[model samples]
Target: MTISCPTCKKPSAPRAENKAFPFCSERCRLIDLGDWLSESYRVPVGPDATERDGVSEDEAAGRVRTPDDLPN
Candidate 1:
């Protein structure tokens, strides 16, 4: 059985033998990771998630989103 590489559209068979699995090579896998890192791909989320993400993003960037977040 054979499968197609998600990155390059190449045939990749024998999943157990291919360390890259869904991708054809380490290069393809890294390329896919880069795409995700660059925001080339986005995952769908709900309104609740988006709201939570805003707070999390601010905190991750060492920001204080609200007055209550200020250090005492």
Candidate 2:
């Protein structure tokens, strides 16, 4: 199926030959990585998130920030 690359928005089909499948190229893939490293990207917490669930936003964010949880 044809899909647009997430980083470049270039339309292409996902193929095993492309190491960066969701992105247009390695350049676009690296640009996305840099954005995340610089904190230009952030996972938005849902509006319904609350302490009532016994998990505050800060605590959940901390859990995700661990190096072990980071993509290789």
Candidate 3:
């Protein structure tokens, strides 16, 4: 199946044939990585981690959370 490169939105090589399957070339792939390292790209987060998973920010970071932090 024909696919488009995520970085440049151009035609990309097939996964079986291309090392950089999602990108047209290594240049485009590195460009995408640079964007990530520079924080130019980000994934949107929703809701607090504590409310969602019952794991508080402290717990998530490997610290102890106080028992007094009640969920609303």
Superior by lDDT: candidate 1 or candidate 2: 1
TM-score of 2: 0.47
Q: Tell me each candidate's TM-score.
A: 0.49, 0.47, 0.51
lDDT of 1 by residue, 1-72 (tens): 678888788997566888998788777777777777887453333454466777788888885477887797
Question: Over the stretch 4-65, how does candidate 3's per-residue lDDT look in tens digits?
Answer: 99888999998888899889988788778877788754332345323545445546787557
In candidate 2, position 15 carries an lDDT of 71
lDDT of 2 by residue, 1-72 (tens): 887888778975567868787787777777777777887543334676444455565677767666787689
TM-score of 1: 0.49
Superposed by TM-score, candidate 1 places the C-alpha of residue 30 at a distance from the truth, in angstroms, of 0.4
Query: Best candidate per TM-score, number?
Result: 3
Greater TM-score among 2 and 3 belongs to 3
2 or 3, greater by lDDT: 3
Please report how far candidate 2 places residue 11 from its true position, in Å. 1.5
Q: Give each model's whole-structure lDDT.
A: 0.73, 0.69, 0.74
lDDT of 3 at 2: 77
Q: Would you give me the overall lDDT of model 1?
A: 0.73
Number of backbone collisions per candidate, in order? 0, 0, 0
Question: Between which residue pairs do clashes occur in model 3?
Answer: none
